[model samples]
Structure formats: C-alpha cells, structure tokens
Target: MRLLAFALLSLWACGCAPALSTFQPAHVADKGHVQAELGLDVSVPTGAIASVVDAGVVLANIAESRELTEGERLTLFEAGGALALNPPSVTPHIGVGYTALDRWELNLRYTGSALRLGTRYQLLKRAKHGVDLTAGAGVGRYVIDLPVGSILGLVELEDFTRWQIDLPIQIGTAGTWYRVWGGPRLMFTTFDTALVVDLPAFTGYPGERELASFSGTGLYVGGQAGVALGYKHVFLGFELTLAEIFSSGELAVLGERAVAVDLDSFIIYPSIGLMLEF
Candidate 1:
C-alpha cells in the first residue's frame, strides 16, 4: 500500500496529468511502448465571461470607428471593466507517452506557453468484457501573455504566470477498432496578471485607469466525454468538456488603485486529436 501511495505521489509530482481529452483507453500500453498525439483545443466562453467577451469585441469595433446599434452600445457599458480583460480562445498541443512499467503510462505534452508531464495507472482491465479504469494527477505552469494594447487600460503586466493542478479518473470500454471514455475531474488553478483598457479619447469618456495586478485562485469541477476510432496503428478522437469554477479568493487587483473583475464562470473546452501508437 505504501509503495502504491508513493507511486501516485511521484506521478503527481511529474505534473503531466490527463486533460479534458483522454484519447487513450484505460488499458496502459505494453511495457516499453510509446505513443504520440497532436490535438487542438478551443475554449468557448459562456455565462458572464461570454457576455464580457461579446461586449469587449463591440468596444473594439467602436474604437475602430465601426458604428454600433444602440443595443450594442448598451451591452458595452453594461459589461463594465470586465470587458477590458481578454482570455485565451484557442490552443494546440502535442503529446508523447511511454509505458515505463506494466500498467503505468507517463505523458509529456506542450501547449503553447505551457508544458505538462503526468502519469496514469491502470487499476482495472477486463479486455474480454471491454471495461477498464485508470486514475491520474497533473500539475502545470503557464506563461499568459495577452497584449494590453490591443484592448482598451490601466493594468500593466510583465511575465504573468498561472499554475494548475488536476486529478482525474477515467473509465471506458474499448473494442478492436474503437474506444469510448468519460470521467470526472477536479482542477485548481491560480494566476496573477494585469489588464489595460483605453476608452476612446475622442469620445471623451474617461476610461478607468487603475494600476493594479489581478490575482486569484479557483477550483473547477467538471467532466469529459470522448470517443475514439482507430485502425491498426492510428486513431482519431474528439472530446467535449464542461467545467464550473468555484473561487477561493476574490479575483481582483490589490491596493487602493484596485480593479475588481469577477473570474468565476462556466467554460467549455472542445478538442480533437490524431494519435499514433507504436
């Protein structure tokens, strides 16, 4: 039991955990086998953040002298300072995995500004019955650099960073040519960054300028559903994930020159991938 616990801890420390898409089956690859994957993930904003993104786009258009209907202008004002903030829309990743020992798979993946290393341990495998189960943990660091100039003004950020840790349990069935899996996950993420918003000088609407940094930590509970189809040595997969964040700290800038932007929101990540096994 102690050895198992130690192994799990070491895996978590490795920092590459399965993400929203676990294209692999719960069955670990044969010992010494290797797998390679390439995928794309797109984040679709929903709830409050979605509203802010829409309003921000409108504000950007107005800055470029694009006229808006009265309703659109209303939305821009309604979104408030939150509109000034921009989040990532799309990211792509490449992953490689190796089975160092029987029933254990270690993974390494790179997605833009982030790199992750993780491991999965197969707990149950019933090939005849087409059932399998596995669990894993992951930790990762990200450098988030979104140019403040493109958006409208008073937060200045240099080398903003985010940290994330997640735990996931996957269960699924696999046949000779296909696999299906879905499972639950818990993710904790934290970040520190600044924002820049500039109201048009021509409009003379004094854009709020507050020189402050934003920092917050939040927990997300979510699940993923995925399907994979493959030939002898290759597979194609797709996954859709939904998660709602519960915050531990208020997402805001510090000090008297403070800006408060709510970071609590619901989000969706959809991904597609091609995998090759050897």
Candidate 2:
C-alpha cells in the first residue's frame, strides 16, 4: 500500500489563458482508487500577446518610414509576420481522479478550450519523511468564437465567453517512485465580448463599420512547480506555472458611452503528463 503517486498539476489561468493542467498537491487516489491522465499543455504569452507582437515590430518600422508601394512594403512585412511570429499555444490534456471519502478527491479536466471539475482535500497527511497538503476548488468554461474573416477576411472575434474560478494550494512530497510538488493558485475570471472591426487599407480610413463591446474581470495569481516519476502503474509529470494577469473592463460601442479598461498581463504555463493508476 504505497501508492500516493502525487501528480495533480491541474492549474489554470484566464485572460490570455489556461493552466494546461499539471498538478501535484499532496496525494489522493487511495480509497476506491482511480486515476488517469494524459497531457500536453503549453501557453506562453508575455502579456497582451507580447504586445501584439510588439505592434508587429512597430509596423515594420512604419514600413521603413513612409513612402510606400512594393505592394505596400509587402503588406507591411506580411502583417509583421502575422503579429511577430505568434506561437506557443498548444493544448491537449485529460484527467480523471476519484477517491470518495477518506481524504476526499474528485477531479475531471480537459483543455481544448476549457472544461474543468474539481475537488481535493487532504490537508496534511504524510509521515515518515513527511510533508503533504492539498486544497482545491474549480469551475470553468472558456470559449472564443471567431469566424467571418477573422483577420485576413477582416477582423472578427465576435463573442467570447469566459467564466472561471479556481483556488488551489498544494505542498508535497511522496515516495515509492518519486513525486514533488509546489503550489499557490487563484483565478477568478469573467468575460463577454463582441467585435467586428474592418479598416485596413493601410489605415486610409473610410472602411467604416466598427462595432465593439467588451465586459471583463480577471484576477490570476499563480505559482506551481512539479515533478514525478513512475513505477507501480505508470507515471510521468512535469509542471511549471507563473502568472499575473489582472484585468478590468467595460468598453462599449454601437452608440458609445462605456469605457474603462485596464489590462495587465503575464503568463507562462507548461505541463506534461502521463499517468495511470487503478
């Protein structure tokens, strides 16, 4: 009976998003056991999509300071390499855990857009080279709907929905293969959106029609660390998370009056997993 293979990196973030799930916070999966996992989640955006790729490298330095034509300077260096080489957003993760009584544990996760269910409580329990603690709470739903020329077709990101709440705390140590953890996570998010902007004849105005609406609230403060190894059933885990994304908003249009937005950002999440326990 040496199977507390801690691996609960089920972290999350919203406001440029995702925890990508790679959690380890003290053990669970003993009483009536059941654990399953699969993962790969990565999100790296150093704030506002890296300032929109540094404003596309400052519009390729303003198309090399005025005087265009060369197909508009190759469409401004291909829209500044599509916003400065945008990359680092990968998702795919799955999780399942159940403990039922005796320390309680229940979790379900997914990371395509978002889907989560959580429960954990094992508040310190590990002796013999001890250290264990766990805490949890979760709720999620994040979706971004964009269609109708989303960028080349001409700007659209109509309707975005986000509703999340998570509070996690974990501290760890485990053996019989190996496991280590770290924690501190808190996320509370809310969102609403609508946008359809068109105007890009090299900003020569007159491409009218601009509608905007945004409603937001976000707070994410994070910390996570992880490690895991395998043996009696298969395990492998790795996690790292760092966060800061404070947001506030109210921006309206379509007959104006409603403005206030203060968006702050920072994020770096990484996860990797492979687990099975029965």
Candidate 1: where is the Cα deviation over 4 Å? 1-19, 58-88, 128-130, 143-149, 152-157, 203-210, 248-254, 257-261
Shift of residue 54 alpha carbon in model 1, Å: 3.1
Q: Over the stretch 1-278, how does candidate 1's per-residue lDDT look in tens digits?
A: 43453343223222111234445555667799987889877655457755665555546557545444444443443333332222434557788889999889898877655667788898888665558888987777764453233332212344466777877688887766886788986888776555433434445444343334456676778888888899856889888888876654333333543334464667677889887778
* Pairs in clash, predicted candidate 2: 8-23, 8-24, 9-22, 9-23, 9-24, 10-23, 12-19
Candidate 2 on 81-171: residue-level lDDT in tens? 2221222355677878799987788888876666788888887878743788878888877554321224323334555667788888888
User: TM-score per candidate, in order?
Assistant: 0.75, 0.33
Per-residue error for 85 in candidate 1, Å, reads 8.7
Position 50, candidate 1: lDDT: 56
Task: Give the poorly placed runs of model 2, Cα more than 4 Å off.
Answer: 1-14, 20-52, 57-99, 107-115, 119-125, 128-155, 159-180, 183-197, 200-205, 208-223, 226-278
What's the TM for model 1? 0.75
